[model samples]
Target: MPSKKPELLVPLNGWKTLHNSSTVLDSADAFYFGLQTNFSMRARADNFPIKDLLKLIEMVHDRGKKCYLTTNILIYNTEMVELYQTIQLAHESGVDAIICHDLAAILIAKEVGIPFHVSTQANISNLLSAKFYQELGADRLILARELDLNDIKEIASKLDIPIETFVHGAMCTAVSGRCYLSAELMDFNPDFSANRGKCVQPCRRNYTLEFTGEENEKIDFEPYSGMFFNAKDLCMIGHISELIEAGISSFKVEGRMRDPEYIETTAKCYREAIDSYFNGTYSQKRVDEWLSRLSKVFNRGFHLGFYFSKPGSDDIERTIRGNQAKLRKIQIGKVTNYYPAASAVEVQLFQNHLEIGDTIIFENKNGFYHKQQVKSLQIEGESITNTKKMSTTQPIIVGIKVSKKIPNTAVIYKFIKKTTSKMKKKID
Candidate 1:
């Protein structure tokens, strides 16, 4: 029931993101990433080096996808010159658009003659602000995360430009992520501010309530100890139809600081959801399956976020402190060699043991990933059922039958499944 199919905008953290999303999944319609510089959000992430900008852009373009460079950080007066250079370099490297919020960054993008997408940091929650950005030549508007589906529809109905919104990922406790808590905690350190993209997430910590009496005595309340401000991750897999019908131009998935495996699962799951919606295969059963798959990846549990209405106490992630993923991956070995004709790879074990019927993932440094169940394992080309844990000094080598070619630089990780009856105390 959408006017048109929306774009699946994904995040790029590093080389793994490039390989997994582009090669392993091939799902993203566009990718948004930050550079090594601090002008963009997710400054703590393993951002791409500026020297690789041209090559990275070429890689995405070769696959017929667009690249949007992120320069959405709050700019100080001293950083204007460097910001201009960054936007200029993005323009030179054939970037599709520069995602930014600061007026200086917006002006610089315009000066450098490049398209710009207003970031959610702009907080364009209403029609007036949406039209303002549209008039300012914003190719796309990433509306505030605080807006509900009705508000989104109302604004999208009046806007001519494409309107983008967060369909999934971490929901900041603050309005549109304009938080000073991290900065205040760091004693006004600009490098640690949420607006500067390096939030330490003090809000996610379990805090207790303390009371001071007239005698200067302190009392602690044990019942109030909880992660009150830790917002549950946004998941719209079940509501893809509603989101599409809201006239959103793009569905953005947050998590630039997450691992590559997280990126792969999220991108693939959302991609399937969106495609299924358009292909007339969207169903509650499929949604359930997608939710199960999503729960296996990195998340702080799931919620509908502000799409339906204001979040209440039920929306807050009160118990789990870290990831609530149902599965954990452990690196066990690396591919030492690949046999194309035999469809096999020589693996050198570094740690844990591997056996038949085990689920494993092959990750390449050059940007390729594959997951398969270990149906075939061999030692010196002879059939084997399992192998012992290899030592670091005298590592054990074995042959694995792969479905496709795996690079020599590819690392292997075994998936450790968990039960739903009880949650693990340590999540890793």
Candidate 2:
């Protein structure tokens, strides 16, 4: 068998509701096996609470995965000490490494005896900067997104330290994310000096195009049009071999503020694609399938972006829209306590209509849905002939324990119909 492919580094910003729970990390570990928690959004000067940070790091580590703490924000004099303290705490808490952009912060990280990775914010587009970081004891360098295949190959040939590059996801119009557009427009600076956590994404806002007529007469070319700086989402899932050959050690996905389902799906896709590419049988059909799945989540339209060159007019999508919610065909029930000695399973049903012999499907951490026949039922501690009017507190007993330990949040649902003859003919 071929060697297992290297893992992708998924950076999460803890913006969506799922990132607030332990289940998100659990799901990520189950799917991706590696993650990077971004502190750029969470580490404000006033809101430097380490409770959630510690919890997230602990959960990631507990799953036997690596967690890199991001100190990749633009730091000012006022926030320097607080940032250092945060880095120190992260180091003490056994974080894998600190991702830093500022040289001063990198120095502080070095003094604290924690390994450092240069953040992409530093704009290491050339081989010299990569070499410089390697000599500075940096273990990894996130390359600027503007670099093409040739640039990557040149840098890879010269660098000794591990190189990380964005394999898929959003593209920033700014050079290496160094744009002052948000700060300049909102009057809230976000560069190397003033470290403000709140960034009003000025790039994604609307704009109106104006035209100049004869003798300085102005005309409205396009009214109230948006996507002014909206670069298309980068999708390089189709080009894995070229990237791996360019010596990229880690393929990074850029969705720090996206949903957990987005994280789960995207990470899993890249995980599989990387494996297939290395095994020498990667296909375009598989890439299309993964991209289609991603479309169901969220996106600003897809593009190959600057990976090839400066993105053309066709590379950008001019409009923005939200993804429609796709409801899952499952229902959740109250969890039960497991007892191996009694060989009995108990679950609280949301609907009281389930019979003893009814078959139902259940989902677990493995993402596999299993169908099982219920052999028996009991209410309370005694056996009951019928449980037609069961209450929420009453535990409904089943015959067989699920193959996998049912997570507290496990959802169960009975299939209403197996197949439709007409639908099958349409598919055929």
- Which candidate number has the best lDDT? 1
TM-score of each: 0.89, 0.68
Q: What lDDT does model 2 reach?
A: 0.64
RMSD of 1: 3.5
The number of the candidate with the highest TM-score is 1
What is the TM-score of candidate 1?
0.89
lDDT of 1: 0.87
Q: What's the CA error at residue 228 for candidate 2, in Å? A: 2.4
lDDT of candidate 1 at residue 88, scale 0 to 100: 93
Clashing pairs in 1: 19-367
Candidate 1 Cα misplacement greater than 4 A, ranges: 21-25, 214-223, 334-352, 362-375, 388-396, 401-411, 419-428
The C-alpha stretches of model 2 lying farther than 4 A from their native spots are: 1-4, 13-49, 52-55, 189-197, 212-224, 321-428
What C-alpha lDDT, on a 0 to 100 scale, does residue 92 get in candidate 1?
Answer: 92
lDDT of 2 by residue, 1-428 (tens): 22435457775644332333344454333212112222463332222236656665666777776777667766767877777787788788778888788887799999999988898888898888888899999988888888888898889778887788887776777787776666777555444222333455566655666554554335435434556686777888888877877777778887765545566667777777887887777898988887777665556668776677888877655654222223223352544665566655567665544666665555544333345666656666665534564445663544344544555555566533313331121110
The lDDT of each candidate is 0.87, 0.64
Tens digits of lDDT, candidate 1, 1-428: 65478999988887667654444238888899999997878998878889999999998998888989999989999888788889999999999999999999999888889999999999888999899999998999999999999999999999889999998888899999999999999999987999999999998988875554444336433435778798999999999998989899899999888877788888888999999998999999999998999999888888999999899998888877878888878788888999999899898997878899998889865546677789898997689999987778878989989887787888999877756544534322
